[model samples]
Target: MRIIILNNFFSGTAYYCFKFREYRLFWIAAFFSNIGMWSLVYGRLWLMRTLTESEIFLGLVLTANLTPILFFSLFGGILSDKHNRLTILRITRLFFAIFTLITGILIHLDLIEPIYVIALSIITGTLLAIDIPARSAMIARIIPKEHLPNGIILYSIIFGGSAIIGPLIFAPIVSVLSIEYLFYLIGFCYFFTVLILLKMNLRLHISKLEKKISYSRSLIEGFGYIKTQKNILYIIILGVIVGLFSSSFEILLPVFTDEVFLGDSRVYSTILLLLGSGGLVGTVILSISGNHFNKLSVLIFSSICLGLLFVIFSRITNLNIALMIVPFIGLVNVWKGTINTTVIQTLVEENFRGRTMSLQQWSWGSAALGGLFTGFFAESFSSPFTLLISGILIIFFSISIGILLLSLFSKIK
Candidate 1:
């Protein structure tokens, strides 16, 4: 009976893989690219901590990394709509690879400094602002509309998997060797992503009317469409709230690890590893059962759970307890993000998908804004206190949103 169950599981997995064969290459590319991105993030944060133990400086680094997403993501959406998304992806990836290589070389020569790291982060952030809209918009092109939710979930799984694997690999390297080597690995991964892109043959089906609209006109139209769609607007607002409160956890993690846990790099990596493990589990669960659940309810419940977890996490002085709570945080994080993305992708029209996703990116950009707030707050008070305040704010906002949603549903009924 156990053998039969194992066989059935393998068969189901194979079938799912076969069904999404059109996205297989993109998935492979995303896996490597995501690993590189995570490695860069881990390395960047570690390096910043080493340079200055100031929470404010760490927050500034994160702000530099995410600021471009706020400014350029909508413009990227305009370009994605106007041009071939595949081409934009390829070009952006190439530029990012080049930038990574240069940074690695500079670090290898012992010429690295905090300002250089901040500058490079800004450049990478700008590239990501362009890359995200194009990459997200391209998913609809490669897969059938009915399979989009699965596709998005699968993509999130790749993301979660990379987050797990990247740190696991880089933690030891950063411990023994140098953070500079991680940059070299990141560059290679980006280059590998370019090769995978070269192998893909995707044809985006854009309407001639879509092609004829000016970029500025397209931007205005996208906003107008979003204004008309209350559901989409609600989701975006939720994203912004989550980004502002929940996402700041990462920016403040180093301080949390150092001051609270009285730990070193290994402990920090362990926390991140646990978080990624939880995210992986969450993604797998979502992939299997997400369609059976209401996406909005998942978002609302997860947000509340995350808020509670953050509050609990803030109070924990024990390393083991803090470690245990982080995985749950990761699980809720992936659940919220996957559901939100699936809903937005499903609701938006094909012509407006890029722009809509760009708006979503802006919601994510709220993390930078949050980092600034958390950084300043951490500098004034403490990391734990900052987290406590963030958690309370999240709980208040989530419950208010839930009540609002309930009222709207009753009125409609």
Candidate 2:
């Protein structure tokens, strides 16, 4: 019996890549693309930090990068539902690669300015507003419905794993070469993804009903669908809260590393590596566990863990303790996100998948808001205090919601 169970576990793990061949190609493309995106993000942040050394500037840049999602994700969703998703994906990736290459050349010529970076960020963010939703919606189209949860978990792994690898890969390169070269590398990474996607056979499956609706009308219907679904509504609310309070960690990390830990870029890289490692571990566990557990329960539990761990992470004065705790911080953070995304994807209809996922992307926008607030707050106060206040507020909010969710679950049970 134990042997049979073990065999099933291994088979389930391999099924998505082996049994679903097309999804494997899609997965590989997504992995490299994500890595490239994250490398760009890391290099951009590091460049900003080295140039300005201002917390508020960091916040502003991050906000510029993320704010487009608020304005354009719905449109992206509409396009995804109305047009060929693969084509949209290809166009956005190509655009990003071109932009990144231009920025690299300017930087190499020592002609790059902070304003140029900000402008580039806005352009990249605008493209991402479309790319993210389309890519997410494409998953359901590629993989069978029964295997979607596994596919989603695997996607999370790519995201989390890339977060770990991107920084590590770039940090050393930045140290040895120059920050300008990092931009070139990022461009090449995106180009690599485009090359991979060029060879794959992709088809966009759109329903007749989706084709009939006007873009604006389709967006409204998507919003209307989200309003009617309580589970999805609650999940989005929780995600927004988490994003608003918890997502500032990355924005503040350079400050935290320098001011709090008295460390340099290498230390910053180490902390991120640990955080990413923790996130990767959490994603692996969730992927292996499959759908055996209750997703809502997992979401609630991981959220509370995130709040508590973040609070502890905020107050620590010792570098060793901070390093030790950050992994758990990564773990719970990714765990919460993975479960939240899977639940939303599972509950949403195919017609509304892109829009619903776009709504979900708002959580990142909320985090962008958090970055702005944390930056100004850190500028006014201190990094540690800003983190402490944010963490405490998250704890209060999460615990309150967790109680309500528990009561609702009890009634359901």
Candidate 3:
């Protein structure tokens, strides 16, 4: 029996490894690095709560981390277009790995004050501003065009899966192990990611004409081009709306666990893991089959379903049923992530890919800000009501965006 189980596990692992080889080591490094990133997040948030015991403080810390993204994202986009993406990614990953190590040391030494956390947040956020754009732009370079959509779906799958699993593992580890050690685990993963990145031979091409343009012009031109794109605009606007309503809800997961679920850490852990499961399922469906479907229609239908799932999740009193429905959230997440990226990647010119992706990052950051606000506001009143309001808003927003998209696409045709 044991041998049978072990064989099954190894076979499943080998299958995924085979699928991932199409993009080579670049995607593997990214997958591991992403897991570390979320692990760090899980550690950071748990550490923050352990220290401050204030939800507001957590929100503030998140704000500090994201504020720089709002400012420097455009610059990062410009660099992505003007430089070698793989090289840029390697440098940033190394810097962040070192930072994670240093941060871990400080935590171990009992030097992790709020001010230090703030400083670390800002520095890490700045590095991410550059790294994220480069990473997103580099995706197209590593994979064949025919496989780009699958690559995107696979990217979402692993990323969302990692996001779920990282926290599940970290939370329990922190419960038994010292919280400071979690940072060490994160650093080690990051170091491994850097090693993998170093080994991957990838180069991004920037044309001479594109090089001649000023950085400011490159940044503005990308946005200008996107402004004239009907599909891109609709997607971005709809994405922002959904993000504003749902993105920050994760920040309050700890609170909901404590208050609604009676301070059970197991329940808290389950919520996050379940969310990841949903995302994984969503990504699998999209990658295997949804690529052949109409992208716009997928986005519209998924957005509506996502909103409804949130509503159902909001009303559930039973934990088991809630867990069952949580994977739907992940499914919607995969749909949103894949559709948004595929649309932009297909519509934008090669030269403008970085800037446009930066815009996507910006939309996320901006939505995070809104989400943070929504979190605090909802917490101040009632958590359940907050979830309800967020769900309703998402539904309304999706309907409006879908109708607008239909009208615009028709006119374009």
Candidate 4:
């Protein structure tokens, strides 16, 4: 076991360095952005708990952040097409940094309240709704088209790297130092990210703004494009399924920690770390593989593999087994990062890249909207049963989508 683990760890590390050297500036900027993001999320959740001491409030706060994406992401996409993505990112990052700093000061002054937090979250969400599309689309500008798959993988590594580092540092620092100070730390990360971004000479890929269409038609056009492109829709549907059910591992894992492992906060943290480590490994694999395979087939197979792993994870009662599978969960996420985004970007024209990405984000927004609520039910009822059901649903849904796409492909051929 030790030998296997060491081998995987070394391999993951080697891949990260090789791929990271490809986009030095964006890679550094991504690391900073993810650190800030992780800090903000940890601070936000902790702040809510400090204010209200209610799980319901925690759920509500998450919902508030997600709600705007469900509604306004389309507009975000439209804006991405019409403007310079770098400029959009710079403006939003500046505001986001300021907001983080102000929130820290408010909390330190004991002026914090649920309303303030919720309102701040809403404002942050509005910025994120715009920022995400620009950020995702900016990948094409940063790396060579042939290396886009590697870019996606490296992006995932940064994401998972943040996941590994963020919470590990986050929980302890806040508990020992002050939660208010954590916000300040996040603000610093963002400001540093802005500095890093300013130095990069990214050739802005701007799509021409066509004749003004009604807002409804603009949105309809994004959907219409996907509808005609069966492969794209297939990827989107699989994304939604994975987002909804297969990816609920974090929510469901606490039960495994408590009931199976008979563990506390310490054990929970360990599991989370293992999961993050797994993700890092997965990202490295995808980064090295680059774009050697059919991305669509990779997506379908990885989804099924992820679902099966979840099913196995749901049934396991032993800590040893849980630890072993943690990396596989991360592996699935790496698969998700590479295939999902690459497929979408390849399918869409530069003009609609933003909106199309935004439409893709809707799957996430909708999933979060649903998952948080369902989680409450799972807690109230039985967690193990809830996890089992969710895992099974993911397996069936993803496979069915894959089959449908396969049949469609056959007909076209």
Best by lDDT: 1
Q: Would you list the rank order by lDDT, best first?
A: 1, 2, 3, 4
Cα lDDT listed for each candidate? 0.84, 0.83, 0.74, 0.73
Q: Put down candidate 3 lDDT per residue, 1-413, tens digits, no spaces.
A: 99888766544331233344436687678878888787765566667767786676666666666667788888998898888888888888888788888888998888888777768877888888898888888777766665666666667777777867776776677778777777787778888988888777653333323577888788779889888887887887888778777755666666667666665556766777777777777777766663467888888888888778877777876667867887778778778767888777767777778888888877566654864775587658766667778788889999999999989888888
Q: In model 1, what is the error at residue 366, expressed in angstroms?
A: 0.7
Candidate 1, 99: how far from true, in Å? 1.5
lDDT of 2 by residue, 1-413 (tens): 99888767666772444357668778888888888887787678788898788988888778888889888988988888777888888899999999999988988898888888889998999999999888888888777888888888888888788889877877688788888887888888889889888866664444324487788799889989998877677788888888888867888888888888998878888888898889999988887787677888788888888878867878887899999998998899898888888888988998788889998988777776887898899899888788888887877877777677667656756
Candidate 3, run of 10 with poorest lDDT: 10-19
lDDT of 4 by residue, 263-325 (tens): 754566667677778777777676766555676777778888877887787788889888888
Model 3 sits at a Cα RMSD from the real structure of 4.6
Return the clash pairs for model 4, or none: 278-327
Residue 379, model 3: Cα distance from true site in angstroms: 4.2
**What's the number of clashes in each of the models?**
0, 0, 4, 1
After TM-score superposition, the amount by which residue 22's alpha carbon in candidate 2 deviates from its true location, in angstroms, is 1.5
**Which consecutive 10 residues in model 2 have the weakest lDDT in total?**
201-210
Candidate 1: tens digits of C-alpha lDDT, residues 134-182: 8998888887777777778878998789879977877787788877888
**Candidate 3 local lDDT, residue 357:** 85
